[model samples]
Target: MGLFITFEGPEGSGKSTQARLLYERLQRLGYPVILTREPGGTRIGELIRRILVDLRHTEMAPTTETLLFSAARAQLVSELVRPYLKTGGIVLCDRYADSTFAYQGYGLGRDLEELQSITTVATGGLMPDLTFYLDLDVEMGLQRKRSARDRLPEPASAAAAFTPHPEWNRLDARDLAYHQRVATGFAELMRRDPDRWRCFVANQPVDLLAEQIFTQVEPMLARIVRLENPR
Candidate 1:
């Protein structure tokens, strides 16, 4: 069977960049690899991604957003992930169900069990064999994304009703308390699935981070090769 790998983290944690690097490295090693991202891996999913990320849709409710994300995930898995897995290819996903759990359940205060159920159905129980979670501070991630702030909402008044704040970019909109909760949620998930999840401190340089990931992945790659080429 194919090996499924996923990268998860808060915004600006470099999960996307590292996923691309790993995909390239795996291809260089002659492994059949497929690179894709959640909320976008399929045509319908890409449309959903535009709706989810567009700053103009600032009034979207938390529940609606959560369901939209799950919908996209279901389409992506059924269209892209399942076929690649069936071909014994290494599937490198930029983000997956974990994002919904972190962003919607933990950050947006949705019910965790409900979100888990949605994810289970969306993925058809096809969880990643390995997940590399890049941990970083919310402040740092916000700072990294602040440079391109043209599309984000401004910070809203704390006392007034929840108007769209320009800083309400997906990750930036959350209060520090919520972001901390997300971090704790991810940590808890790691503890709960220690065999499948690996936590990495992503406060390092890109090359160094890649090297650390390679160290963990090399053995897994060897095992994949052994299984594929049993003599």
Candidate 2:
């Protein structure tokens, strides 16, 4: 099987940046790799992402939010992720089913078992080969998000072609307590499957963090090569 790596963490944790860095690194090494993000990847998934993140959707129920995320994921896996993996290419995803568990199940107080059932159907039992959890203080992460939102250009500006500050969405409008639970949820997930997770302090310097992540990923790539060429 091809390498499937996921980045998970609280808001403003730099998961997306790290995923991109890793994707570039793999490409430089002549490995086939693709970088993608959750809630949006394929055409259908992008539509779902719009609904899921729109700030006006504050009234969206927990179950509805969960299902929407799952729907997007189902489309992403079938259309992109699964097929690419079949060709032995690496996939670097910003988030996956784990975000659903962390945000909906733990943060929103939804039933974990029900979420698990839904995720199983959405992903068709696909799981990440390695998951990097970029650990950060919840309050600090939220503050970073606020600062980022403030830096975005106005909608009418030429630089702002699409939505203005898309990352600052309805989920970011949630309370600090809810985000704290989500962080706790991530911790619980890592504890449950320690072998598949690599936790890192999100406050570290960017280059240092990227090097650390690359060091961990290099061994996994070697393992994949050995598996494909087992004499």
Candidate 3:
């Protein structure tokens, strides 16, 4: 199977940019790379994403949110991710099941054990080979999101009020304490799986951050080259 790399962080952490940079870099280096995201990878996933992020759905229960995300995840894993991995294509995902753990399990005070069980079923036990956590100050991330939304010219989506810009959603508009909890949750996750995750301060220059990521992924490229041209 191909390498699965996931980018995890709070909103405005610049993880999406970094993931895109890595995907382009890998492609330039001639690796077959696939860039995708959770809650909206496949068609079904997109529908789920709409429901999850649409600000109008403020009544969405936490349990309902979790299941919706899982439903989208199941479709992505089965429909796209699995086959692409079997073909040895590198998959760079913006968010995966870990978001559930951070947002639902940790931030919303859901049972971590239960969240893991559901996510495992949704993903069929597929795990990322490397995960990059772009640690950002919760406030800074929020500010960045606000700036981004301000800069966008054609802003308001009739589908949703909260900017899920591949960005923040209804979840992000909550108070600082809620977001802080999510950030803390991310920290805890990194602590639990130190080996699988690379921590980076996302406040740095994009080029610098991307370079650091390349250095890490460069070693993995060896595996890709070998698999592609096995002698």
TM-score for each model: 0.85, 0.93, 0.92
lDDT by residue (78-193, candidate 3, tens digit) is: 99888988987888999998889999988999999999999999999988999999999999999999888777666557553454555556877888998999999999999999
Candidate 2: deviation at residue 220, Å?
A: 1.1
Error of 2 at 62 (Å): 0.8
| Over 4 Å off, model 1 | 148-168, 223-231
* Local distance difference test scores for all models: 0.80, 0.89, 0.87
* Rank ordering of all candidates by lDDT, starting from the highest: 2, 3, 1
C-alpha RMSD values across all candidates? 6.1, 3.7, 2.9
Which residue pairs in candidate 1 have backbone atoms (N, alpha carbon, C) closer than 3 angstroms, thus clashing?
Answer: 152-166, 153-165, 153-166, 153-167, 154-165, 154-166, 154-167
Q: Whose lDDT is higher: candidate 1's or candidate 2's?
A: 2
Give residue 92's lDDT in candidate 2 (0 to 100).
93
- Write candidate 1's Cα lDDT for 20-137 as tens digits: 9988887777777889997688889988877777656768999889889989989988888888778777889998988888888878889999998988988888899899999999
